[model samples]
Target: MHPKLVEFLAGCRDEAPLQLGVLPFGMICGIASLAAGMPAWLAQLASAIVFSGAAQLVIVQMLAVGSGAAPIGLTAGLLGVRHVLYSVSLADYVRHLPRRWRLLLAYLLTDEAYAIAILRYQAQTAAVHQSVPGTPPGNTAPGATGDAEGSPVRDLRHWYFFGCGLTLWLTWQVSTAIGIVFGATIPADWDIDFAVPLTFIALLTLLIRERANQAAAAVAALGALLLAALPYNLGLVGAIILGLMAGALSTRLARRTRLAREASQ
Candidate 1:
């Protein structure tokens, strides 16, 4: 088989395990959308329109409560702003691609795809650096014009990304469809809704590996508790902003402290 197809299949294969968590997560969203009184067609349409599980839940919750559009817009923007950061972090690896390639890959990008694709790209960088003659151990600054761009591995890497993303997208769509069709028949006592928070809590545990993340999460929880009475779900918005600021501030402080220790030594 061609290398491009190989890479593509590699991405799909790697993303398979993560779909275990995703299946139930998507089902919860579909069931919630229906419970919120959305039409079946509209609820399924939302899986495509607002792809993020968290964002969809927030939007559907607001709609269920009869909130105004202004708050919904703000909340959605905040959720999407994280994607900009994800794209920027991955931009250096994809810089040489045509605009069409970049745009299509950008749509496929997601939290799971990104986590897998980045590690693959980094491993490529390391592999090339080691295999090439006279390359420095630390010289991984391989942009479009660099040594990595000329290699076959570089050519096929994006296909892997596409594969991973497309698989998740397909799984999400199918899971949502199943939930929508059999939602009413499912027993109420199954307590499947508990999976909603459990899934995110598992994800949150993976993310909070440092003081900065801990700080951000703590502030966000406190902010939400304090501002819970705010109308139009503005309290959640404030909590998000405060959490971001706290994380940023903590990161800067940690960097400065490390720099100071190095200077003294």
Candidate 2:
């Protein structure tokens, strides 16, 4: 098999397990769309464009209550503001790709995709860092970014990202269709709501092993509690901003502390 294909397959394989959480989220979006009086076709189309489960859910609820276009647009845009940060962080990894490829990958980039893909991209950077300890970031690390002397991982990373994104995309579409058709028939006793948090908590715990992550998580939690009264789900958006800021600050502080220790030595 081609190495790129292998990387793609590995991404698909790794992402498959996480669909346990994604499937229900998609289904609920479909179900809720139906309950909100959205025609099946439009609901499915909305699913394709919106893509993000939480954002889709908020949009559906807004549509249900007859919210105006402006508020809905503002709310959805705010909800997705975090993706800008995700893209900025990921730009270093994919900057060398052609524009078409970058656009396609950005479309595929979601919270789930970002969570999984960023880890893989960072691992590639770490490999380079280990190979040349003390090399600075940015231009120095473009090797994983397809410089003439780029690492194989950098050259083939898009394949893995494509694999992960494609799998999630397909799974979501299929699950949405199922919900549109049979969502009303699902038993309430099944209590699928628990899976929502359970799945994310698992993802969260896995990512929160570091102090920076823990600090960020704590601040986000506190922000959510304090800001829960905000309208149009602004609380959630505020919490995300708080979390990202906390994480970035903590990461910078840790790096500075490490450099200071090394300088002292």
Candidate 3:
């Protein structure tokens, strides 16, 4: 077996649950799109090509509500803004590669893929930094050079990321096809509505592990509820923007406060 395959398998074992969780949601998006009267092929294509769960759900929901294509396009655009950030972050690691390779990397840069890649990248980076002189013990700066023996390990991380992306892509395609085929057979009263809220609540709870993130989440929730009446689902857009701004501002403030305390000491 290739060294990277072993590392990829190890990393994937730890991510099994999250991988399963994402599949059902992606399938649900497919079912929802079909239920919303989307063409079967369209739903399947969206799941195959777009591969973003939240954005796909939002698009299908809008379509179900008789919303215009423009709004759906806009929603997808707004949700996809996160990809730009991911690309920039990943650039530091793969920037030296050929432009053709970069294009392939960009296509595979979904949320799950990015998470796995970034974690492996950070781990390799920290290992490298630890080997360097004058660097902190735990600093994980990208581009930090690992020892000669560690080069194989670092090289292996890329294959790990590729495997993760490929696995997710296959799962998404299979689950989506199933959803499109059997969506109408599922009953509406199956009590699946709770899943969405529960998933988000779980996500929110995780994000609230820090005081600043907690405060920002609270503020954003309020802003979203207050603006919930906006038409064309612009309220959703407003809520996201407000929430992001609140989180950013609060996090900056918290950092400043911490710095001030250190200075005072």
Candidate 4:
């Protein structure tokens, strides 16, 4: 097998484990959509179009409760605000790719895909940094770029991203289809919708390694609970904004403190 194919397959294999969480969430989104009175076809269509479990659930719930179009749209848009940060962060690595590939990647860019891709990119970057002439071995920092000689890794990066994204897209679609088909059969007492928050919590646990991230998450959770009475689920949007602000401020302060300490030393 070609080396590129091997990388692609490895990417798929690496992403396989995440499906354990994703599949159930996808199915729950589908089931919840139907349970909330969304038509079968439209529910499936939202799965394809929105491809966001959280956003889809919010949409379905709002629609079921007869929410106005503006609120529904606003809620979905607010839920997806994080994607803007993902796109900006990923833009540099994929900037050299063709426009069509960029467009497709943008469409397929999900939380799982971003997590895997960014980790891979950072690893590759660290390797490249370690290889630099003046840099001591094993002393590479984040955000370092590999040399032009590392072109092969760079080339394979896109294929690996494609494999991961495609796997997620297929898994999500199939799982959602299953849910739509058998949703009515699943007992309401089962409360499959719980899987959605469980999946996010799992993802959040993985991401909260830094103190800033931990602080942000704490603030977001508290804010959401306190503001739960907000009309049209606007509390979610508010919580997200507060989380971002807290995270950003804490991160900046940490960076500044580190820099000042270094200067003093």
Ranking by lDDT: 2, 4, 1, 3
Error of 4 at 180 (Å): 1.2
Residues 158-261 of candidate 2: C-alpha lDDT, one tens digit per residue: 77888889999998998999899999999989877677777778678767889999999999999999999987688999999999899999999999999999
Look at candidate 4 and tell me the lDDT of residue 84: 94
Tens digits of per-residue lDDT, candidate 4, 66-140, equal 989998998899889989988887876777778999999898899888888777776766676667745432233
Q: Which window of 10 residues has the lowest lDDT sum in candidate 2?
A: 136-145
Q: Give the TM-score of candidate 4.
A: 0.85
What are the per-residue Cα lDDT tens digits for candidate 1 across 20-64? 778877888898899889999999999987788878888888999
Estimate the lDDT of model 3. Answer: 0.69
TM-score of each candidate structure, all chains considered together: 0.76, 0.89, 0.75, 0.85
lDDT of 1: 0.79
Instruction: State the lDDT of candidate 3 residue by residue for 147-194, as single tens digits.
Output: 766452233355555666777777778878877887667687875445
The regions of model 2 sitting more than 4 angstroms off are 134-154
Q: Name the candidate, 1 or 3, with the larger lDDT value.
A: 1
152 Cα displacement, candidate 2 (Å): 9.8
Model 1 error, position 201 (Å): 4.1
What's the lDDT for candidate 4? 0.80
As for candidate 3, its clashing pairs are none
